[model samples]
Target: MESVSTSSVMDILNLLKACCSQSCNYIMTYGGTFSSLASEVGQLKDKSSDVKRDVEAATRDGQTPRSEVLGWLSSVQDMEGEAESIERKYNQKIKCLCSFPLNVCSAYRLRNRAEAALATIRELKQSAEFTKLADNLNLTRSIKMPTTKTIGMDKVFEELQRHAKDDSLSVIGIHGMGGVGKTALLRRFNNDFPSETEADVVIFLELSIDYKLEEVQKSLFDRLSLTWQDEVTHRDRATKLFRVLSTLKFILLLDNLWEPLNYQVVGIPLPAPPSKCKIIFTTRTEDTCSHMGTEKMIKMECLEEEAAWNLFRNSARMDVIDADKNVRIEARDLVKECGGLPAALIVLAQAMAPKKTWEEWMHALTIMKDTPHQLPGMTNNVFSILKLSYDRLSSDNMRVCASYGALFIKGSWIGKFNIRNSWIGEGIIDNVQNVMDADHKTQFLLGILHAASLTVRVHDDYFTMHPMTRAMILWVQRECGKKENKWLVWDRERVEEAPAAEKWRDAERIALVWNQISDLPEAPQCPNLIFLDLQVNKFLRKIPNGFFLHMPLLRILELQETSIEELPVSIGNLMQLHYLNLCKTRITSLPKEMTALVNLKYLSLAFMKYLRIIPDQLISSLRELQWLIMMDSYSGWKEGQSCEGGVSFEELESLKRLKVIGMTVSTLAALQNLCDSPRLAPLTH
Candidate 1:
């Protein structure tokens, strides 16, 4: 697995040239009789090849058996083996240089036998024959393809033909439920799209995961057989590909198109006025399909009842579908519960696949009856069955995490990118100990919530949760404030420890933690408390007394996590403080003395929660402060809260410590797109 760097590939090429040169020179010096054979071997090579262009150019012009003589010289080198055992056995290492697609072993076997036979010639010092043998060491490179076919895609051929015929500014889309056949279909196309046409170049780009515009552009440029040899940025790469597309008729299959992006801004052509170039795409939403302006949006129909029955038959493969009438009836009932979504149908059918009697099917049906469905336009009901796993968590963070389902309970496709942005904007994530490059802040939360079954990861970095799970989050948010399992309080047993850990955990737990807690906690320790979220809590009128001294660990302490409002004078003692988020809190203004925490990372003096002006010192001494989320969370005063990031990513770069972290997804599309974090391991709510 050596990296294919220029220096490495170049070094290899140099060594190969030197080996060929030595063999050729040794042959020409020989006064042997194998001249005719050498001439024949040299004739088989073309000048454009690596061996011919480099080695053949230097042989004595009229020399006939030059290579023939060198092939013999190879025996002399072998016999003069630095160590006697070198020639004792043929190692694959020697013959691996032979140009073949991993047939290095076979090449070694043949070279080994040649060595054994030529050992006699080596001992005799037949310089001519040894040179001839050396010249015979031919190595060439060959490309290889995987032998077996990738499974589960039956619609590839049809799509390929469609793309080929409509190559003029065309947009063919594939829309279906998660895990059905959209991505797989595109994958199959990626594998076999290049047929025989010279204008035929296929490039596949994923718009969901790792949605960096540069990545898409680079993939397209590479496929078009073009290279700038310069650092092509995200913007430039997109531009380069667009320029290429305008000339060459290429097949560009944009996968997981969820948003209505202006590709032109990124240097690619728009879909509205067809350019007579084929651009096939796949989306889960009809709205996205329409935006592409495709002549035909194949609204994928659900698997037919017969198709569902067959899926059940294949999955179950039991006698229930054959002999027992009552068993068959129950099996049919199971399929109905799956709603004909292929992913659900197969997953559900498989659980019952091995069952025999009617009673087992009946019990399963009973369980299915209990699970709830997502809201309108959010048909994520199939996995309500998975929500049962969340109930098993023992932690409040775990329970609060169950609320992730509520966002999806409404059938919202929470793209991973937008979710990451939401998590950051909402201030759910704080900092992490470099478990896996702390750069991935939200990923940790994703893993924890996913493990707790409070979130269901969907296609293209999108995630969702069942309505029941969303209900669980609401319950946890309400319960987090209770004295017994208060989400805002630090470990009751370890109050002097870090309330930041407790508060941070609770903040990340709620759909909007700032909206759940009334004020910051009073822990004597925990300097890692960077975020203070006072978002949703409506009960408070002022900050806790001496709150600043008690929470020296406070970075961003938001009181909006509950119904409380107010600011305590002791809030200024936090020296290591960073982000101070008081979005929905009822605080009026920061005390001029509290601006002493010169390390504030982000300071939001926004109004909607109704604060007027930032502390005069906050505008100056707190030099490192960056992001400011001052917009309304749905008019913070009343019930219908709007949770959106009011700050722009561009303006926040001035803070220096801030990074545009996480894969951000827009709320309008999907939520599951960004649930890639594994660090939120112990803190998922």
Candidate 2:
């Protein structure tokens, strides 16, 4: 009993000693622990500041904060608040309990709180060491772009969206004329990407009139969050881009593609079969679409009339447009002048929005009709945009050939054959030895023009220039100074009579088509004249005696569907004439003097129902003649028979350069002559 009692007393004594020792420790370590907590909290605050700074910088560069980093920052904030609260309580307890050693309970509670906060602060400081402060923003999968309200593009947009999701299609192309809203459509397409798309990233790039491959490379690098090193080689950059692109599903939107760009050259792997990556591009030419190997092509046509008015009314505000009947009339007429092109309509509407009076509208209309490009917004926005297509043409020959579209009436469907022949006659297509080669080159050039979107193909053998495009071309030509001044165009100028001799003196090319010119000057000293078009001059019955005398350098003379019945004797003086079109004329006979034309290459007399005679030797004397179209007009061939100095089929055999001949034979002898001659028989159609 004595031993057990002694053990129990010893345990009680040990417990009291332990309590006394813990109390002493709590009192002694309180200040150090609080200091430690304050120091760690300050360190955490500094770390948080550094991290926030880094995050801000990364965000400025189009990056976003990492999820883990954000969580850590939030934890640090909470820890800082707790540490601050503990410090305030400790300070308050010390201040209130100063010189009073009896308040151990308050001191103990404050010490306990500081100890707890110190531990938390230390943990936060340890976690503040972040290798990466922020992650890439990944350039939003679909950026909301600022664009004009879509007009007549809902169906096209829906169709494009379907094509974009199509499993079999990897590349889609949108092609149309300049200022036809291709870029606008692309912007809308990019902004309206579905949330459920499989794409992990979408990159939009605008290849300028002369974009470089490095520009594309840099865009990829930026969007992919790869560091761009300026000192690296192009191949190295391409490899880097390809490495990242191969692992992710992405959509690349390429806008304003002037020509075919090799995807491989730019380090873009072709999204061929089995690849989830896709590419879409917008260009002004279908040729680009074909060359780029697009799986689907959507042609962006001009808005319909009603849709155009809607767009215009929205832009110009309907209140002003419908304020007066005259204003509405003028507005509708102005829309027609815009030719349903969105860019033109938008610009014109904006320019006309401020003018409320009918007179002001009328003045604007007159200016638009006369010089559309000179209007306020037309030059900068519409015409200059169209000029890019012309400026990026492959060569000067193409530019010149394209400029010829301006010579015709605006918005007219130009016959491809006539255009090709005109190109041949102007010496634009040189260095060819045979008519076949010339035709081949002509076809290639036509393809180039079509691909450039300078001319829109209406059919296989016809193309038409947009009215706005024509106006832009004419403006460009006029801007080239004196060189283009030689081209005199009066077709759309509302000129009833031929210009005075002074206007015709320095002209190199003249277009007097669709006019009521009843007479021409006796002679104009046009020493540099190369082209003259008198087409569709219904009232023109006679050519002055010396109309062709001074045009020694004349190369093309067109008088199709004219009322003229005879050619002047001076017609033979145009020694350099290459193309002579008298189709649908009233001429009954050809003079013998036409035999002087040795350089004539293309001669068309088709539909000349009143044509009856071609003096013998006249056709053969044109040693350079290659194309002769007389089908449905001249069938007065009589072989081995003398009939009013008429041309025989056998005489056609003498012409060695003729490659295409379209004429009819009315006599058996003529048919036999045609079959007997190897050259003529092979060329005859």
Candidate 3:
């Protein structure tokens, strides 16, 4: 009897292996026909392996295998037999073509046989008993709630719940100032609605400043547990999403909307008559509510005086015994300075919780009083409160990262990878032997900023700071005795002329982006400058010769979306420069002197419509270049340009260390040559 059982197990194992291999190949050859059966075949393969292991253990222990194990083996064998029969039918149908005379009639006959085989396979797959197998695979799991307590928003939560219950309302809008507890109130509503209502599904998504419709669709697909192919087009994804959502009663909660979102673009069906879907979105502006066509608008207000004090005491862990009469007075005075904003109150209280003595409390108050408020349209007290929190950071590296957040446009989405690479170039992240270590340290610094509420995480590896937080960072930079470290004149500030020569001497980083400056001034005296960003200056014409004479430590230069006709030959003097961005310019050609930038690692020349060629000599000199972007240029020969002047594929052989290269369709012929070259094959791969 034992010998019979062992034979049965071995037969099952061999059948299962053949069944899995054939199913995988069939799916690969005929896409979409055998996809449904693939899952069942995989489960059978797993069950067969498990049963084999159990039987082996039983034999080793001198005991018989359990009856349930034998039953699983029998079921797997039966499934394998069905799979083999189907694969045999498919193979036989294909074999008809071998004896064909290669005529239309023979082709038609073979096609009919193939269709019959596919239909048979589909019917068998549908009739198979997969309930028991599915039961073992699917398991129940619970969703965890937020651990942080929601304070001082009881009335707001009640109002939001009321809005959610109205059957006529499709989109509900929540608008408030930044740090006014809008997100917290939304989370509370999301947690409570499923238990109190009859919605079939609940989804929460965070939209960043630069969010795309495809991203939102993918998020919905993930939340619904739906399977999607990676190669599916945007329209197909939208159609599938709409079909799935139209039949269910669902509620979508979107948080941190920087601008008005279009539901149609994101493939979300409107909550019209007969559709029970509802959407709730939060934004910082009332205009955004009007733009989104919210049926009901709710405005979030700050906490009252008593509630603010309660929140402050709770966050700071101050009890009655700890707060005497004088301490109560001082605490009340400090809370008043928070402007009834919950985030400010919590962050300030947490910063002050460590100071138990009266002198310490008084000293913090003195510092707040001494700091000057430079932000327009913001109250002085609120500014002081945020600045005090900035001062309380534990490390200088954290402070530097936080201050760097001020360099971006107030509502721009900052990519974490770009920020980390820039930090490495600027020498802010030290002791890093390689790029991987620098990335880890950058993430750590970003975490610190997020914990302190100095920045908001819009999505994975992307973040943006609140306008008030940005103001505080700028304030700290000006007052922290580092007056010459940075000069940021961004936000479309109209600049008819550049700063005086003396003003640029002490600055290390100078950004005059989004300005109205029409001319590039000569900066022959800037000895300490390392980074310069003059992007989106539409009227700037050209860089005069010898413009980069004095700056030897320069590492990053950005001239994207500018009208610069050419770069100065003097730019080659900065042998230490590593990153140069010249996208969306009108430069006709690159200067031969540019080949002198031996330390260059990243070069972007995308969207230069007038550029006709890249010289071969220029491409071979940058041995350290790792990333080269030359996409979307006008590759056709210019009016007077010769074919010999175009980029040569042979020049790429010397770039042995190249890691990434982006080019347009016109460069495919050249790319093919590079791929065929013996020395460049590895780099291309």
User: RMSD to the native, candidate 2?
Assistant: 10.0
| lDDT value, residue 210 of candidate 2 | 75
The candidate, 2 or 3, that scores higher on TM-score is: 2
How well does candidate 1 score on lDDT at residue 469? Answer: 43
Per-residue CA lDDT of candidate 3, range 348-387, in tens? Answer: 7767777677776666665443331422223344556466
Worst 10 residues of 1 by lDDT: 133-142
Global lDDT of each candidate: 0.47, 0.82, 0.68
Stretch of 10 with least lDDT, candidate 2: 93-102
Q: Give the clash total for candidate 3.
A: 0
Ranking by TM-score: 2, 3, 1
Error of 2 at 553 (Å): 2.4
TM-score of 1: 0.34
Estimated TM-score for each candidate: 0.34, 0.75, 0.44
Query: How does candidate 1 score on lDDT?
Result: 0.47
